[model samples]
Target: MDHYSFFDRDLSWLLFNERILMEAEKETLPVLERVNFLSIFSSNLDEFYRVRIPVLLAVHKLAKRGSSEKEDVLLEAQALIGYQQQKFGKIFTGQLIPLLKQHKVNLLFNEPIPNNIADKVMDYFYSQVMSFLQPIDLADTKKSFFPENNRLYFFISLRTANDLERNVILAIPSNQLPRFYSVSVADEQYILFLDDIIRHNLNKLFKNEVVTGCYSFKITRDAELDLKDEYHGDLSEQIEKQLLKRDMGIATRFLHQPGIPLRTLHFITDKFGLQSSSVVEGGIYHNLKDLMSLPVNNPLLRYTRWAPINSYHVTDEGSLFDHIEKQDYIFHAPYQSYNTILRFFNEAATDASVDEISVTLYRVASDSRIVNALISAANNGKKVRVMVELKARFDEANNIKWAKKMKAAGVDIIYSDKALKVHAKIALVKRQVNGRDKYSGLLATGNFNESTAAFYTDHIMMTANPLLLREMELLFMFLAKGKKSAEGYPVDFKHLLVAQFNLQSRFMELIDQEIANAKQGLPAAITIKLNNLEERKLIGKLYEASQAGVKINMIVRSICCLIPGVKGMSEHINIRRIVDRYLEHGRIFVFENNGDQKVFMGSADWMNRNIYRRIEVCFPVYDEKIKAEVMQLISLQLQDNVQAVNLDTALQNIRIEPKPPLIQAQRGIYEFLKAKSDN
Candidate 1:
């Protein structure tokens, strides 16, 4: 193994979070959009602490006392995130709210509200929100109050008629009520958080007690769901049991008032065995992410909706299968319509010839039309086999619900077997054409979510090649049966690089070939576009290639740990991150194999989990025209200066200094596709 010094993964992830914060800090972005950026930053951090940080903590505790690197990494991550969290608070409270006020939108609290508005709020709370309040007196009760994930609570302190301090805990019923309620007075419209609604009604909630003050806060727990070895019982049932305990996860971070009387804090912490260090003194309000749901009775506060552009390859007159039969068609999602992939399934369902449909669903939308079409296929007497992964992060419940729905629809459902989670996005359809068995399949980089398809850039390869589609069917067969002893067909994968089989080796070989070409004074280059790049071995290989004079250009949207542009180390490597209107999610790899370029796009990223652990597929672009189009898209992204930010050696995100006449890549690509359609 090559001696490598890589940035810690957790710290690198924190840097990604900071980059998101940087977007919030940008004055160029719209004021409301900036607030949305802060909301995104907080939500992303909540998930990071819930899933990733807890795993690291578990690994550290299991290892006992070997390397200090893990602990060090955790400490550094906490410090960096803490700094960024402070910055986020400052930006939101100091900058964004003031800007919103300038736009005539004021988010007010209980700081001497104007008498008329205060009376109106009190009347509103009494008639509309008072009945929803449930208060527990903490002074006399031995029963504890445990808040669920992302739930808001208020600690109310009161002075009784006997001149004694008493406390009551109230749960904010925002789940049942809107987070923001608009109240209009004379000529001004004011927005108030539901927290304030409860705040305004404190005296009503504690009718007998005289309310002194009430503070609003929340706690985010470590959300890593643990599971045991599978037994003879049903797996779905077992998962359901485990999921019920999801709320009981260890508390990771607690956001509370700055000084709520140390005794009161201690009482609450003692009940939960939480330490003060884990407790963050957040502002008066908790769960600021509720800002994302800002009721837009005013359409001017929201972003203008943009329709997803349709791909040039898809036309109203033809079956998607017929088009794929001619040549491999690549669907670039959000940019190119996801309807192409949907039409593929819809057509397969309606076609009398299609005999079987197999798909692997990871994170699907709640109202998934994809699942609806799959059900329609099963109803049409087609063999619909769905390998629904219930282990998708934060989406386990949704996946489980869909799994039961699909199972009830008479579709064959397969859950994951062992330690592996099937993260692949593949759909195989077996059809009979001219009384002969023909196959079609789709391999995508992102999940089959229709709503997200309008905002997330993804690539899906639709093909009718028997050589590839037959293997996909077999692969799903093996996945469904859980037959580990069964070997895959001994056929050469000329186009697709399936993980757990050939993806890693193929990537290494491609990198080595580039290195060799560079040494031989030939044209050698590589371009990689991925959501994350954190695998140490792959980064080392890229560094080796870079040292050998191979130019590498990388567009990694998140969690990039490699240090680029270092003298004598990775001088030839260029790293850029694009945060634009659409999420840059498609994973594409282009290698200059002695100038005979090879381009591939699929679900796999450079993360080790994607390559060596999970089931992923990266398929080569066979059609020259499509390959050219993909190359043009990649080239446009490579040259993007408007939304692109360069990553420095220390991972500090430096804004890309744009040229005079700048190009925003997504808009440019839309124009490019439109021009192609016109031609």
Candidate 2:
């Protein structure tokens, strides 16, 4: 076998973020949409600092006695981020702001407030923002203050009555108030940052002191929860306690606006014990993810909305279960309405025949109609079992809230072992049809979240396949035991590929089959779409198949470690990345078994966390029509030139130039599904 190289995961993630920046740079897109891409880029970077940078820093420290490989990767990551930040600044200031101005909307980006709107800005601040402001005098050691993670604050330099210098920290109330304040003067609209609003009114709070300088800053902390593997206590309570400390975790990045005095910076760093943090000089405004709330609603300055097409028709007389039992159905989300899936749960909740309901809730929506329906099912005398994953990062609180509500409503709630997270998006319902147990199931590529379903492109399959649903019920049964490992589980899972048991091995076997056929002088190919691609073993297997003359194509939205188009290793592999109005989130796998092709779609990405640590379900497309639909969707994504970019050997996103009849996969999928619906 040939030796292969992989891109550093952190650097590869940065490359993905850069693709987002590229979308922000497109002049043809609506200015606000471009601003949204910038917001997404900023938000993604903050997550990297909170999650990945700490891991990198720890690895760098551990490598003190080893090679400098870890240190080099860390430095390269920093350099790449710095370059991207500079590019972000140029795009925001040089391109987007001007475009907004052309549309009679003025966005104040690091600029002083105009004199015309001074009265309106201060009036709004005095009435709405003053109550949320909390200032701590850093000079007074008796008063204790800890800067919360990712919350914006400002360092103030002041001269008091005694002519002595004092330092104070004031928390920006962006959490309490809108980040951008909008006011209309005549026919033009002007948007002001809440940062500027507070900056303009500092003297009012400090009546006896002279404000010298003020700069904004925020701290990014490690987001990992410290869940013990063998804890006998309530996991929900344990996670809730950990979540309170999440904002106070050890700081990983101390991002501050430039031009702070050196002594002030050091004093603040020492006071907060941020000595080991990555101190970075950022823009005048911190947390530009707030740009998503620009407070301007101009339909003409945004992408014309595509109404979600009703793909699955559920009549008043017929329940969703009636359609599923007759034939298999698939719905592409955002392009197709999520109401069909919602109605699946809604019907199960009310149907007198439904005897039991089971599901895995990883990330539940805050106002989850699905959870409400589950609660309703429990009240309707149906057996409800929910494996609520309390370990879903950043969503621990919301999931816990819904779990408690469901438990209160007499629903049987199951929690996964601390070490294993059930990332599967699946639901099972058992009904008594003709006094016999019949089942209908839903397996999807994304969360069962109605909120995310509106903006995230995902695929959901509603089926009555007995073999598949029986295996799903067995998996749920295994989860009920709260076992840390799947080693002793009796389920074989021949039809469904589940992580921790058969998902990885089955995928490897599929790749091996492709390699075998390629070596036999037969046409062999593989296509996969995932949010991330990082497991080295699977990547190596893909390389081995490529060496055997199997063609591999992948659409990885972010974090690809496998270096494609490499000589003697992965010469036949091609990777595409698509970023557009909707997040490309569905995970699809296709393999050519000589002449017969097999397709699987589910929640599992090839990331190590998904394969080795979590319980994920990827089910086969057994129906010929649904199989053709899945194949056609992947084909469109592979042919996309407008919103898709190819990953080169160096892992850079290379734009696919416009050929004749250029295709944007998301739009094309919508149109394709629309025509089908019309027919």
How well does each candidate superpose onto the true structure, as a TM-score?
0.95, 0.98
Tens-digit per-residue lDDT, 1-679, candidate 2:
2477888888999999999999999989988899999999999999999999999888877777585554447778888999999999999999989889998999987778888898988899889999988889876779899999999999999999999998889999888888889999998899988888889889998999999999899999999988876777899999999999998899999999989889888988998999998999888898999888788799988899999998644555677788889998888998999888998999999999999999999999999999999999999999999999999999999999999999999999999888899999999999998989989999999999999999999999989999899999999999999888999777798999999899999999999999999999997999999999999999999999999999999999999999999999999999999999999999999999987999999999999999999999999998999999999999999999999999998999999998989999999999999999988
lDDT of 1: 0.80
For residue 267, what is the lDDT in candidate 1? 72
Q: Each candidate's lDDT (Cα)?
A: 0.80, 0.92
Q: Find the candidate with the highest lDDT and give its number.
A: 2
* lDDT of candidate model 2 versus the reference: 0.92
How would you encode candidate 1's per-residue C-alpha lDDT over 329-410 as one tens digit per residue?
7777786667777788789888888899999999989999889999998898999999998878778888889988888999
lDDT of 1 at 70: 51
The stretch of ten residues in a row with the least summed lDDT in candidate 2 is: 64-73
Runs with alpha carbons beyond 4 Å of true place in candidate 2: 67-72, 312-314
Error of 2 at 205 (Å): 1.9
